[model samples]
Every structure is written in structure tokens, then in C-alpha cells.
Target: AYDGGSPTRSSQMRLDIVILDINDHAPVFNQSRYQALISESLLPGASVLQVYATDADQGPNGDVRYEINRRQSDPEGYFTINAQSGLIQINKPLDYETRKVHELVVQAKDGAEQPEVGTAFVSIQVRDSNDNQPSMTIIFLSEDGAPRVSEGANPGQYVARISVSDP
Candidate 1:
């Protein structure tokens, strides 16, 4: 550079710049916790619910995949998740008598080499259905081996013992 009235001089230089995409953002779930109620008779492979997550990064760093966190939830392998859609499905039969409620920890991870993950708590309440048949047992209270009631039996008189259970 030179003053306007004196002399002119110039210098030339080459400059190089590069922009890189980095995994700087972790996946974030739309909700911290989700709740759902489903009938115990719901068949396997049926959709339970869908979880959502997003990342602020670009490209692969923002592509999120879903999974059931086995270490934290679903030890019995009762549920499965779609990596692309975050749709959760029943992997096994649900029985309200066996398990009334199920708590799961769902995780979403970015496509980065060292993915940043986010976790969401999912509580599923299994509603009891009439899946089980009612069972009954009868015991005779008379001296004979058969259940019998006398015509003169008064109210609340013990005639036979009956037990019924539905589970």
C-alpha cells in the first residue's frame, strides 16, 4: 500500500479456508416423558407410540436413530423401536395380570462417529382385558359327597362352598 500522491505498491497473497461439519449438538426429545395406555390384548407388532427427537447440527450429525435402551429399560425384550421413524411396537404379548405397567427408557442417537444421545422416559399402562376366562370351584358342604340344599334351608344357610377367580 502507498499514499495517494506518493507511490503505489501492492502485495499479493493466497488464502485458503475450509468449513467442516462437527457433531456439536446432542439429540433432544420433544418430550422428557411420555405416557400411553394400551389394552393388554393388543397383539404383537402393534404400534404403541412414537417418540420424537431432533438435533441442531447438519447432515449426518443431525440424523437421529431410535432404540430401546436395554441397559435402562425393557430387559424382557417386550418392545422394539424403529430407527428412522421412532415408532415403538410390541415385541411380545402384554398381560395385565403379569405386568400392569411397563417403564422404558428410549434413546436417540445422532449419526456421528461418537454419537450424542438423548433419553426419554416412557410409561405404558396396560389395561386389563377379558382375556382370561373365569374359573369356578364348587365344594359340597352336606354330609353326602354332592351339593344339596334342603327346602327348609333358611337364608344365609351354608349349602355349598363356591370359589371363583378371574385372572
Candidate 2:
């Protein structure tokens, strides 16, 4: 029997492969600071300011999610955000007495697991508007010159104390 041996001559094989980049880390914000102002006179629900961010990765890996991180100090959520759009809008009225400036931190995350996180600071300055009227604590002085006045005081009389609060 005759046997044919293999590999007597050298041969070559060709192959093609592509490797995609992994989005291990997300894009981070360079500056995590911001400030803004909205006059109390402005109509309620008015768009005050907008915040923006950037992503370093490509494709869906670069897609980011935006959200507002509320602190314990902020019982009331005074701001809103558009996740896809990265827009921040005011959600409540501001009272100077209660809060003159609002401090907030915005977070951005990429699609990757344990995605990279970025932060931004926002300071909102509230201006005074005629909308807030001051009311006196005392309703009115008695005609008999009595220190204590009875209930049902006149409109102009000192009825209650008025204060302003902002968020």
C-alpha cells in the first residue's frame, strides 16, 4: 500500500477579525459647578435655565442619563430635568425669606455597567417680585386705645406677618 504524506509542502491560511472598543468608563464633566437667577416676578412654571453635558464614548455606549440629585436639605424638589435632552427646568416658586439661593448637583451616567459618573453644580438666584406683598402682624389699634384688638380687623389693619421663601 502506498501512503500520501501531508505537510510535505508549506501552505498558508488567511483570516479576518475585527475588535470593537469597549465602553468601560463613561464621560465625566470637567466642571461640576453652575449658577443661575430667576426673578420672583417671572410667571410661575417659567423656564429658568438649562444644563448641558458631554460623552466621550462612541455609539450607544456614549449615551448618557441625566438626573438631579436632591439633598436632605431639599425637602421640596424645585427643579426638573429632561433625561435625553439634558435640560433643567424650574418646578417651584422661590421665596427669598425661605431660600435665596438653590444648590444642586446634576449627575450624568453612561450606558456601561457601573457606568462612569459626572457631576455638575447649580446655584439659582431668586429675585424679588411685587407678587409677594407684606402684611403687618397687628391687624389694627382699638379706638379705645386698647393694646389687644378684637378679631375681624380692617383690611388695611395689621393682620398677619408676611415672609418670603425661595428654592
Candidate 3:
């Protein structure tokens, strides 16, 4: 036991680590609030409208999945969404008298282990279709004033008839 004891030294080392961003995220629908006008009397297989979105991620991770979350808004599933194309179509005709614009929320998330989510809003404007006929409402004119004539009328017509079109 005549040998001297050895001393130990303490030092610190640096390490380099990098985290690559993945495009595993699904495409997020910017239009969370979407409004589409579907004709109640539309022919089957008619194209209603198309939806759009973008993803922050790239590659397969960026590949998005689309679905209509109208579980609450449309209990019977009146709409359809294209997963790969992001197109929204009408599965069934929509009655403007019953419902004019549909309100829905679309969600987008990354495919990463810890995913990220984003959202957007949309407003769909439905145009009227000449499906429903307009009911005539005759009004007796008083001596106060004459019927308001249209400046761009067809020679003899008084004014444009008030006929609410359908969608």
C-alpha cells in the first residue's frame, strides 16, 4: 500500500442536435365557417361548390384528410367532402326555405407524434334557382300614388315582379 492515489479530472463537452420539421401535418381548411347554396330541386350528381385548404407540413405528412363535420349541423349527412381534392359536394338537395346557409367547422392537424392544429372560416353564398313558382300578392292602389315603374322595363311592364328564387 505504498502507491499514491490517482486524481480524477472533470470536464464538459458540447453536443450538436438538430430537429427536422416534418410535413406530416394534414391540410388545414382555412374556411372554418363555410356557406354553400344548394338547390333543393337540384338534379342528382350536380356539383355544388369546391373547398380549399393548405398544410404547413410537407410530403405525406402534409397530405390532408377531408371530411364534413356536420354531425351536428346535418344529422343526416347532407354534404360530402373529397379527402384528396378538398371538394365539398351536396349529397342531397338543400331547401332555402328550410336552411339557406350551412355553418360548419373544419379542422386540420399534423401527422406527427405531437400534432399541430389550425382552422379557418368560409362564407358560402347560394344563388336562387327558378324551381319554386312565386305566389301573386295583389295590392289595391290608393289615389295617393301610382305603381313605381322600372327605368329599365320592357316597354309596357310596370316593374320587376317580386319572385324569390330557390337555390
Tell me how many clashing residue pairs each candidate has.
Answer: 0, 8, 17
Judging by lDDT against the true structure, name the best candidate.
1
Error of 2 at 158 (Å): 21
lDDT value for candidate 2? Answer: 0.69
Q: Which residue runs does candidate 3 get wrong by more than 4 Å?
A: 1-38, 113-115, 133-167
Q: Quick one: best TM-score, which candidate? A: 1
Error of 3 at 16 (Å): 14
Give each prediction's root-mean-square deviation over alpha carbons: 3.1, 8.6, 10.9
Return whichever of 1 and 3 wins on lDDT: 1
lDDT by residue (tens digit), candidate 1, 68-159 = 99998899999999999999999999999999999999999999999999999999999999988999999988898586888999999988
Candidates 2 and 3 compared by lDDT, better number: 2
TM of each candidate vs. truth: 0.85, 0.67, 0.52
Q: What residue runs in model 2 are displaced by over 4 Å at the alpha carbon?
A: 1-15, 71-75, 135-167
lDDT of 3: 0.59
lDDT, candidate 2, residue 41? Answer: 57
